[model samples]
Target: MTRIFSLTCLYILFLLSSCSIINWEVEPDNLKITYQDEELSEIFHDHILRFIDEAEKRDMTFRSGKVNIKWGPELANHVNATTFSNGIIKVNPSSVKINHDHLSLQLISHELYHLLCQPPSAYDHRSRHLISGTPYVSSLMVASSKKGEFPTIDNVEMWEYYFDELFLHHGDYSFVYDYESNSK
Candidate 1:
C-alpha cells in the first residue's frame, strides 16, 4: 500500500508539472510550498529555513511567515528562480540540491529582498493589504541596486522597467528608452 501511494503521488506530481499554472499547498505552521513532491518535501522545508538564516545573517529582513517558496518541477522550463512581488518565489530544486553557498546565498538574498521591499501578507490573516501591490519583484531588486541596497541582475530590460516605477513613486521624474535603438 505504501508503494502504491508513493506511485500515485509521483503520478500526480507528473501531472502538475505539465500544467500551465502551478498549484500551491498549505503546509503546517502556515507555511506555503509550491507544488507537491514527497521526495523533495523535507529538502524544501530545510532550504526555506536555511534561506531565512542566511537572510538574517546578511541583515536582511525576511518574513517567512507570509511567503511561498516553490522548488519543485512546477517551475517553468529553463528557469532557475523567479518571484512574485506579492511574495511567491519559484526556484528549481536542482538549483539548491548542491551546497553551492554562493548561488544559494544570492538567490536567497534576491528573494528575501522581495519580501522585505514589498512585504508579503501573512497567510493566517495576520496582516492586511490596503492596495494591490506591484508585480515583477525582481525589478524591485534592481531598484534597490540603484541605491546599493540589493544586487543588480543581468537582465537590462527588466532593470530599466523597475527603475522607472521606483523613481515615479519617489518624485516627479520619468525616463524613457527607445527599445528598438537598444535592441541591436
Candidate 2:
C-alpha cells in the first residue's frame, strides 16, 4: 500500500510538472499569413521561417493558436507593430520600411516573442535599467527603437543572443516591476 501511494504521488508530480513545459515544435502549415506589400510579404515570410528554425533549435514552446499576420495602417502612438492574444500580429508597413530589413526582423521577432511567451504586461518590454546591467543588452523587445537602431543583418552573435534571451529567459521579470515601482 505504501509503495502504491509513493508511485501515485510521483505520477501526480510528474503530471503537474509537465503542464508547465512548453512544446516548441511549430507547424508552418498552421500559420495563415496576409500582407499588402509584396516586398514586405517576402521579408515577413522569411522572418517567420527563420523564427521557426530558431524556435525548433531551442525547443521553445509557443501558445497554441492559428497565427494571423496582416499589414495594418500606421499605428497610433508611433508604434510599429502590435500583437493580440488571439494570435494576430499587425505591422504598420509605412512605419517599418523595406530598406530597414533588420528593423523589420526585429519587430517581427519581438511580436512573435509576445505571442509565443504570452508574458504578462510586466515582461512586455525589457527595462532599460535591466538592459544596461544584463546579458540581455540587445533584447529585441526593447520598448522602442530608432530607424537605424538594430544591429547589422549579418551579426550572427547578436541575433543569437537576442533569440536566446527571448526563449530561455522569457519568464524572468526581475527588475521589470522595479521600474513600475519607481515610476509611481
Who wins the TM-score comparison?
2
List where candidate 2 sits over 4 angstroms from the true fold.
Answer: 1-39, 119-123, 129-137, 171-184
Tens-place lDDT digits, model 1, residues 1-184: 9999999999999888876352232222444455445543443455456444433444443344456656546775455566676666666765542244333434544554455434445211111111112222322323222122222345446444434433233222222233223444
Q: TM-scores of the models, in the given order?
A: 0.33, 0.66
Error at 20, model 1, angstroms: 35
Give Cα-based local distance difference scores for all models: 0.43, 0.67
Model 1, poorest ten-residue lDDT window? 123-132
Best by lDDT: 2
Give the clashing residue pairs of candidate 2, or none.
24-60
| lDDT (10s digit) by residue, model 2, range 1-184 | 9999999999999998897674444453444555555765776888877877788778765665356777677577487878887677887766744457787788888888887666535447875433433333456778887665566679786677667767776535553444335435
lDDT for model 1 comes to 0.43
Superposition error at 105 for model 2 (Å): 0.7
Q: After superposition, how far is residue 29 of candidate 1 from its true place, in Å?
A: 12
Clashes within 3 Å, all models in order: 0, 1
